[model samples]
Target: MILLLLILTLLSLSRGRPNSSIVNHSTQLLRRLGVKRVPFQFDPYKEGLYYTNLDQNLRQVILNARNWTQISTLSNIDFIRAHNVELGRMQQTIPASSRFPCNLSQTRSPDVASHISRLRPGDIDIVAAFGDSTIAGTGIMALGFWDLMVEYRGFAYTGDGIESWRTVLTLPNILKLYNPNLYGYAVAHSLSADVKRSRLNVAEPMLYLLDLPFQVHVLIDRLHKDPKVNIHVGPNDICSELCYWHDLEAFLRLEERQLYASFRLLRDNVPRLLINFIIQPDIDDVMNVFSEMPDDCTTKASFFCNCHGKYKQEKYYNVAKRFFDMQKSIASLPELQRDDFAIVTHEIFKNVSNLWSRNGALDKRFMANDCIHYSQLAHAVLAKLLWNNMLNQTDFTLSEARRRPFEYFLCPNADRQFLRTTGDRF
Candidate 1:
């Protein structure tokens, strides 16, 4: 009776002809069980279409399958072994020698820059970040679906200060090689943002463009209370992700007004600050990468940009482009470019699609299990890109950055001193 029920379920689920060997085996089993014929006729054309959709749904189910009790009861050793495997995989692509070189005996500038424009990499004392999950370091070290929820803040590309650039290449880690006393970067995994470990990385997961102002306020408040912080000569390194979502012009206009007001607040409260505004990649390019991913991965990624469909993608792309242009315009505003404060827009990720493909197939190694967030290797590469962009290196491109046997960008002879630049001015 149980076998009969199981066979009936399989037949109902696959209403089309059995083309695969597994399906043929099932048909043979049904015959041995005294089942005369299938309840419905099979259509060859529909079989192809039906199985395609069924395969996708089954993949999603399999991807999401996890033993919750086992995951909850996992030992520290289990996690360590998993992380080791992941680290080993990443090292296979990016070796330890490719990590940014560190100079432990390096010294800070004798005279810290009183003006933001004159600040060097070693001059930065405080590092803070805001925006979305990318800045917060979501899923950078994830090995599975369960791990994807864990925010490995220390692995973030922007303001992470982990062991060293060798273990995890991040902007803050690279800067630490110059300034050992650099403060405010998240050190380890944090289940929530309202924890002591979260530090100055106030970025939240799944946050929209409009939520940036709130994050700015939170960061400002934290900075004021921290006793170790001295805002006078201590230049703050602020990294922010400003990606677009809404299509309405009014929405963009409102965001601009709020962001401008937030900048004004920062300028009024915090002096000697260098804000790095990271512009996201093109929406069409992101969608193209999604299209190349497995069906389950694409379905998961769609939630991030559900507003963008086959017909509406162009509109979203235009809006995102406009938002990026707005950021550039805002950065160039004379009123905002004071000696004490400066906002520099980094367009390194504007064409990130170059890194998503290799040999005409989606590079799964560069993406997390969810296929939404970047993998650790991807973060390491982006760190190099950001560093190169800040140094105003024109030769380094995204395509070259993602190449195998990864190579760190060499500092130009004239700019080898780790001095910071707006990339637009000296």
Candidate 2:
């Protein structure tokens, strides 16, 4: 009987179906662990964690791919709904106002979800979002706000879990095998030496300054190569506040020179694509804590009081205005109006600010243990925003309320399914 089973297994392996071959091979994996029987039925989306091989296989679907196109129009989503706890305020740690503490968790509002739901997927089916922690869904781990909306779009989810800086190739051609729906997704991240800057905070403004044009070029090029790709670029890359408070005299010089080179390349290579430009509201006022300190030579005195006290939020709002202006300038580039590119205004930071103000109460988990990184709630907001920003179609409509199913998110309890390390490397 064992010999007969071997012959049958060999026969099954010869078939062209990848799953059949996979399951047969998986049966061997089970046998090694003293589990004899294997079910023929498997749902990757729901059961992915159980079989490490399957999870590994799915991970491969995103990392390595080329010559791919994906389609889906409207995204229906489930946000990981959970109760939140409000705990320590940033003021205790930063010695600043309890009101303003680089708090993104407070800024994750869902009204944008409604706007997103109102969009239409049109002809595009796939999306590629590439950038820093904002795109990585930092605060809301289970499902970033973007993921929620993308789900509604009827496309696959491919963004990485955290700040996948400059790794534009996260989901390469190989990912297409399982996600026949795959078009492509790109991620580009730049840090101010890692933790110094948050989207709510501006880190190394110079790195972004120089890399922007080049990254923009890559986005355009990819869009051209694959028109099916609805590309969202620039939000996680630029912060209007940096220039507001920071004297760009030195960095500006570098950017001015590098930007021209990069722009030239982008202009020459970037294809027209449906676009969304990410912008922050009140960046100069709120984020550029240094915008008004006399460029001459000032200590933390003048702005410090204003930052934590009364004028505190005024600058943020004002700086946000300037940031919006810059967004407009960037979008107005002659290329934006071209027949090929469709620019979508992603008033991202404004939405964030709204969330911050209306965040009912704080969820202790919303703040990271380090007082910098966000907790799960934060990532959920990010995923929500991403979902909103990406699906720019006229027909699709999104929900802004926190009405998502808990089960949909890949939660911590799912860790039981973590794959055993294999000796192999991809």
Q: What stretches of model 1 exceed 4 Å from their correct place?
A: 1-107, 192-194, 232-247, 310-315, 394-398, 403-408, 412-420, 423-426
Give Cα distance to truth, residue 227, candidate 2, Å.
16
lDDT against the true structure, each candidate? 0.55, 0.30
Q: lDDT tens string, model 1, 4-86?
A: 00000001012122224433443444344343442233543221001233443343233223222123423353574367455
Q: Which ten residues in a row have the lowest lDDT in candidate 1?
A: 1-10
Which one wins on TM-score?
1
Candidate 2's C-alpha runs over 4 A off are 1-122, 136-180, 186-207, 214-267, 284-321, 357-377, 386-426
Candidate 2's TM-score: 0.39
lDDT of 2 by residue, 165-192 (tens): 1111122111222233433332212121
My TM-score estimates for the predictions, one after another, are 0.72, 0.39
For each of the candidates, give the backbone clash count: 0, 75
Cα-based lDDT at residue 372, candidate 1: 72
